[model samples]
Target: ELAPRGYIAEGWLNAVRTREDAYPTGLAMPAANIAIPHTDPGFVAKPYIAVVKPAAPVTFNAMAGMGAPVPAQIVINLGIAEPGGQVEALQALMNIFMDTDAAADVLGQTTPQGMVDAIRRHF
Candidate 1:
């Protein structure tokens, strides 16, 4: 979705996959398990946050759990254009995830637009 809008480079998906393999981003939140996958800024054409809720849970490695598996129902892909921005964005996302009400609000949305709206409302 982001590529057509010029938010990322041609190999951004591959790059993010490779990076996720090396440094996992899955977090086990109170409301839901989630993954925040991203790559280096070079692959990003513009900063964008892509939120996805798969039809079924997707397995991801826990960020700080040394390869522990996390079945993530929500995935937030971050396309950040600057290194500093990545940290800031992650911090903000963490805040939301840590808030049960906020996380539940985001997870409660059924549609893409509704999800985006929920995120924006909490963010």
Candidate 2:
């Protein structure tokens, strides 16, 4: 649905899933464990970030050394067409990931709009 909505290429979702299955994007942060799933620029139609908070955490391999399995509560689907922007976005997200207080605050939001607003304020 997100891909067909013009946020990414037709096969972007499959690409992301495949990439994640192979490389894993999970990060074990001080605040909370998270996974930043993304695909190459060729699979992107426009730059967008989808914030998904599942009712239950999903296990993913950690991005760090040894690739430990981590249960992530927050999954950010990064849809960036430009490499430069992807780097910048990841850097910003890393900051939020490390901030337990900020991450908790963002997760406390009860609505989608509130989550977006929280992200904007934090970033």
Judging by TM-score against the true structure, name the best candidate.
Answer: 1
In the range 80-110, model 1's lDDT, one tens digit per residue, is 8988688888888888888999998998899
Q: Global lDDT for candidate 2?
A: 0.84
Q: List the residue pairs that clash in candidate 2.
A: none
| Model 2 misplaced regions, further than 4 Å | 64-67
Q: Count the backbone clashes (under 3 Å) in each candidate.
A: 0, 0
Query: Please, what are the lDDT tens digits per residue for candidate 2 over residues 1-123?
Result: 585588877787789888888878888888988889898888988878889888999888877445688898888888888865677888898899799888998778888888888888888
lDDT of 1 at 46: 87
- Worst window of 10 by summed lDDT in candidate 2: 61-70
